[model samples]
Target: MRKVILSGMLCCALTATFTIDAVAANSALVSPDRRISVALFIDAHDQAQYQISHDRQPVLLASGLGLALSDRQFLNNIRSIKPSDITEINEHYQLYSGKQSQVDYSANQQQFVLTNDKMQQLEITFRVSNDGVAFRYRALEDKRIDKQSPKPVSVVEEYTRFNLPQQSRAWLQPIAEAQTGWEHTNPSYEEHYQMDIPVDQPSTSPAGWVFPALFKIGNKTDNTWMAITEAGVTANDHASRLQARSPKGEYAIGLPMAAEVFTGKALLSHDTLPLQTPWRVIAIGSLATIADSTLGTDLAEPSAMDTRFIKPGIASWSWGLLKDDATVYSVQQQFIDHAADMHWQYTLIDADWDQKIGDDKLKQLVDYAAGKNVGIWVWYNSSGAWNTTKYSPKSRLLTAETRQQEFAKLHNLGVKGVKIDFFAGDGQSMMAYYHDILNDAAKYELLVNFHGTTLPRGLSRTYPNLLSAEAVKGFEMITFFQEAADKEASHSAMLPFTRNLFDPMDFTPTTFNDIPNIKRKTTNAFELALPILFVSGIQHIVETPAGMKTVPTFVKSVMQQLPTHWDESRFIAGYPSKLAVFARRAGDTWFVAGINGEAEAKTITLDLSFLQTMGGNIEMIVSDGERGFQTHKVVLSAKTEIKLQGNDGFIIRITPKS
Candidate 1:
């Protein structure tokens, strides 16, 4: 506990968390093209604050900027300010699998040097790309400190906040990790989304919302969307999310808390000082613009693994909504046989693979899968590496020495990857564990999928072998609630702009078996389009051999060719949270998918003027005749239109016609 110094009525939110008297000065760093800008300055009370505006409208409100430390350092105080230094950056890189294989971007940067009363220094740097703005703080160690100064460690709290315009709203869900081990996990992360919620009284939850929190910064007509989240999260620090300051307060950056899991006594991190926090990213513009933004991967640290080992493709996964028959050896071979016949790249052998009907049976399945020309992946309880807790079996991976041994054993067994599950928090230890596992997986050239863990912050870029993350309300939830299907269409529409914008999603698309009692949310035709709609490097489809037997052969034929990643991505037309249309290209062929969220029919148009500009007379593979997977060839034109019934989807393929 500490003293609370009384200051004048504090401006709400980041208006002025830290107070000291001073003359106000403001400066902005603009995008090279002058379209996006981030302004920075100190308030009358020397509290550092910043705001972002795109195309001349405020996207982020005036918010406080600083960190509170148990060490009592006032890191955001501005003793004196130097005009910001401006710099220009232009670069390009290749993604093993993404909306696009290559990305070209340029941005402008503005940096300021700030020092507190004690002469402790900190730097606030902002990068304003045409697509978004990201800011990070660097604590500069002062050499003038006494030799006896204790090594500065840990972040007690964060003052960084996003005060959205009152008219603006957010699409959010509570974190599942916070409720994982609790007595009642009612508000688990697996719950449905609360859409288009106003900022003033954001949500009913006391725990706040999760990352990639999508916010619409203006009225319906203004249509400016922005997501407030973090990126480049390293082992040195834990990841963070927005929490309402008061139950009715605006959102502020804070660590995840589950009471028992993250006791108030536990701070955000213990990394040494002179540290740089992960970037707080704001991807601006429309849902499509959010989907097209490169800031997420751009802000992430680059890959540390050989690109050769990173093979991202559609895998057949067990232990999800459907695949349960494979509990024993004989039945497991059928999945391998089907995977080979379908030409799918990988088959995941989920949990319980280590018991008596286990490794021996697993080896048989592994060898059988290999001959069938398919690779195998397995799931493990990451915590069990240390002790038996939660899903941790005695065979779990806990220590580095053990991780090495496990990876080696799996590697020799011909396992292509591992899905480490049940990471219930995002504290420093949890964050470090993620990093350590990524490094170890890299050594064995094993790709990874993180389940029951914090959202991926472009870790796939930093460690290319780390594939998809199942942190979203994916297809698995369909097995849990009847309402799951009711929410699917809008949820699918919202995901591209929200969750999938920054990280690849493992929605486990393409399921055909009807639920026992609940009405299926979408059509097999709509389901046919998911491989194109939801973007993930490893697009795991939840189809078991038994389930696929009942699916239409034509639909299965198209499902066989869903591209896991694209060479390019573009946002087409549609309203937010209602309807969405997306276009992606893998190479010479292009895939366009649309989802209709209404209870009645809706129509949307496609303008192929871009294709015409590239001078191509193409073949059109249309799926709009009351059948989603019905494929037909037609001469492509600059304009085409179609009508979709409520809760339905459609897809079209454009390939050049010689």
Candidate 2:
């Protein structure tokens, strides 16, 4: 047995374990593996702050933590702090759809009770894991702190700040101005990332930067990376973003815009006692550790509903390439046939389905898809004065009664899922709106795909029916303009380390054929690699039937056999916004994908040693020259050297020797 110190002088005994000792003014918490450590203390101004270090090296230095309630401030004039005894957490869980199917979560948790000069108390809980640190604020149930009954309080603002080193480089996307973009659908988390810039650099948009922000400390030699994001957001609270102005590289949390509400409903978070904020997660360590960490889902509440209805597979989409003209019955039927031909699972019919192909015709198309062993996913415009876009099926899902009615109609029509698009923002009301939809959709067993929406923030784990969300600047944007197409190579490379790091992104990637007017920069091989590179439960392929017919037979076969759910995933090599190579395994087969986003060629030593023991054959596909495909069959020993040209990509499939 081991002795552990708690509070100021209290002591307890437990089985031998690893834990940090702390008392009163200064409290330290270390991870189970003793790799990551956190220090919580009160600054000279009596403000609560925390710092983090990995392997004894500083990752985040002196970050502020507190809240500004409508009744009183909770950040300064701290009178006392009581640290709780460290608790150990070790558990295993399975996911229906994610980067990895099996997850083993282990962490050390502790709570700090802080009382200000007013004698009012606030509680902050910290959970330290080997991958990173996660913390959240809560209201205590102690009656001594407040004599009267607990009244509902409003969270005016959060004082949490992430202080990054000035030397660190960042890859962050600027948050869009709410209700400002086309059709007032801005703040949908679709802006291009400001890649590899200084941490102190001000954001282009005054609204600030979006979550899952990636930062590289020191130099390339150091190879230290840290990504900041939030998880477990509930209806009781609002989603948050980093402020635009980072004074001395310290990013403070910012609330949603004034116009971001649910039909002009509640904006600020208002709740009674026994309230808990979302977990502020910081993933720190090497690029591999950051990429492999499942802290986003680990900290989330477990699934309460049965997930037997959730299916992970590829989808054939018509809207991205064919635009509004493709929402007709004939086009949707063709895509359904295309999905059947590719052995895909679903076909998404986007925008104005109600008008373009009336309800009768849509039902007919759904029946036709069912005949072809394909499921139909119809689109909806989740708008009600939040956005002015005139997409049909709009205003039909704003309320629970109407939303469930629409879902029942779709279920009766044999539709498999609904793609809800164009949400306003991340206010408290909007967050609750999302929860309401997910809860209602689960009742009908309808899979949800959120387009023109915010980052998922681990919603898929809680609501397994939520398959994919289009929070990134996806494939549709490439067809709209030349500028967006030009940035595809670099932007795609940054995703695995940022936006797509912990959530399913409906980027609707891949189009082997040409866009109507834009000059597509990335080669066919690059397009082919995306289905395996990106992890989306329902991957909506943008390529049309004609486009699919144009690719090589082997390429079609590869697309047909792609896996949406993975058993495991490992980072192979490369950097953000430049090159990315990853290996994902599904069952006995492994899919290795790599992309080079730069104008020049790059060479990296690939590590396939893990597969050597299994004794497999490597079937590789890469750009033949440019805008072409080439296949190679090789055997690996331990390591292999591969080179990729400008705007190029490659995919390798490892199968057991036959």
Worst 10 residues of 2 by lDDT: 17-26
- lDDT by residue (tens digit), candidate 1, 522-580: 76666777778887878777777778777667566666776756899888876556877
In model 1, which runs have C-alpha deviations exceeding 4 angstroms? 1-27, 75-77, 146-152, 180-188, 245-249, 258-267, 321-325, 384-395, 551-553, 612-629, 632-638
Please give the CA lDDT of all the candidate structures. Answer: 0.70, 0.85
In terms of TM-score, which candidate is strongest?
Answer: 2
Candidate 2 TM-score, C-alpha based: 0.95
TM-score each candidate: 0.89, 0.95
Candidate 2 residue 188 Cα shift, in angstroms, is 0.9
Worst 10 residues of 1 by lDDT: 1-10
